[model samples]
Target: MTRVAVIARILPVLAILVWSLQGVSRAENALTLDLSDYELTFEEDFDRLDVSAWGPGTRWIAHTPWNGDFGDAAFADPRPGFPFTVKDGVLAIEARKDEGGKWASGLLASVDGAGRGFSQRYGYFEMRAKFPKGEGTWPAFWLIGLDRLTHTSEVDVVEHYGHFPGRYTASVHVWDRKTASKSSSVHHRVLVAPGSLYDDYNTFGAKIDADWIIFYFNRQEVWRQSTPEHHKQPMYLLVDLGVGAGWPTENTPDPSVMLVDYVKVWARED
Candidate 1:
C-alpha cells in the first residue's frame, strides 16, 4: 500500500512536467496578434450614405475612361444595371458589360487635383466583404496614399480576380522616389482557400505598426512584411470591384457583384 501511494504522487509530478514542456513548445511556434486591446478610432455608418463621414482628405471620383457613379450619394445612377445597389444595408459594387463591348462600371479615388483624398499614417485597417467571381473580373479591397502625403506608399491588402479563382494577392509598393529602387520594396503572396472569398463575406485586414506589417484573411494570418522604413505612416481604406484589368484579360461576359459588409478601423488604446 505504501508503494502504491508513492507511485501515485510521482505520477502526478511527471504529468505536470510533461504539460509544462508542451506549453513551452507551443509558445515558441505560435504567432499571435491580438487587436482587442485597441479602441475604435473611426467608423462609417452606411445607414444614410454620408460622404462627409469620410473626412476632408477624400474625393469621390468615377473610374477613369468609364463614367459611372461610385459613391453612396444621391448623384449615383438610379438604375445602374444589375449587381450594383444599396439594399439590405450593404454596398454592392458589381462588374457588368455594357452594349459598348467594354466592362463599364465602378469607382476610384480622387482627393484633389493631386489625387490626395482619404489617407492616414499608421494604424489597423479592415474590411468585411465577398468578392465577385467570373473569368475577366478583377476585385480588390485596398488602400493608396495621397501623392503629397505618402509619395509612393501603396498598400494592397487584398486584390484578386476571378480568373485566378481562390487565390488572393497582397503587395506593398514603394515608388523609386521613396526608395532607392522598386526592387527594394517588400511584397508577398498568400494562398487562400479555394472559392472561400466569393463564397461568403470574410474579414480582410492589415496591421501597420512601427516595425512590421501583417496581413490577415478571415482572422487568419497570411503574410507579413518587415519594412521598418515605411511602417510609420497611416493609410486609408478602399473597397471596389474592377474589371478588364491586365490580369483578368477582359474575358468576363456577365455582370458580377462585389458586396462589402463593413469597414472598421482601430488603434492601440494608449
Candidate 2:
C-alpha cells in the first residue's frame, strides 16, 4: 500500500479512539453519591410511614404558622394527606391547587411546627430525590436556625424551580442587621447538560463546618464558600414542595409530586 492509503486508514481509527476516550472522561467526571468516612447521625428511608420517625408525630412536625414560608403555596399538616405521603418506600410531596384556586403543598421541618425534632451544629446533610416535572413546581432541601438564627443563616442544599429544566441551585445567606437583607450571600445554579434531574433520583448534599460550606450534586462537589459567622449555632433540616416562587404558573400542571428516596445526616465521630 502507498504511504497515503496507510495514513488515511490510521487517521480514521485514531479519531475514533480519541472520541471514545473523551466520552469516557465525561462519564468519569459525573459523581454518584458515595458514602465514605462520615459517621451517620440520622437517616430516613421512608420504608413505611414511621410516625415515630417523621410523619405527623415526634420525629417531624407538619407545617404551621411558624415554619412555613416561601413561594405561593401554603403548607398544610399531612393529616388529611393533602400534600405528603409515604408509600411504596418513598416520601412524596404533592403540589396542587385547592377548590378555592389557592395552592397547597407540603413542608416538613425538623425542629418546629408543633413538635420539635432534631438539630445538629455542623455535619453532612443529604437528600436523594427526584423532582416533579411541571412548570412552576418548586422543591427545596434546606437548613435553617433551630430555634432562631439570632441573625439569619440559611443553607440551601438544593432548590429546583421546575421551570428551569435540568438545573438546580444552591446558596448560603448570612443575614445583615435585619432579616430582609444579607451580610454575605452566595449562590449558583448547577447545569446538567443533555439530561433532566426530574427524570431520576439524584443526591444533593452540604458539608458544613465553622470555616466553609460545600455543596454537592450527585455527590460531586459543585460549589463552596466561606461559612457565615452567625451560623455557628445548630440548624434544623426542612423539605418543601412549593409553587410559583415568582415563576410563571399560568401553565403549571394541576398536580405534581416530588419523590424523596431518602434523607440522611452524618457527622465526624472525632
**C-alpha RMSD values across all candidates:** 17.5, 15.2
**Cα deviation of 187, candidate 1, in Å:** 3.0
- Backbone clash pairs for candidate 2 read none
lDDT of 2 by residue, 65-93 (tens): 15434677777767656677888889988
What's the C-alpha lDDT at position 4 in model 2?
A: 17
lDDT of model 2, residue 107: 76
TM-score of each: 0.71, 0.81
The residue-by-residue lDDT of candidate 1 on 169-247, one tens digit each, is: 6766554333222312344545666778778888878888777777787666667676546445656555667664444
TM-score of 1: 0.71
In model 1, the Cα lDDT at residue 239 comes to 61
lDDT of 2 at 2: 9
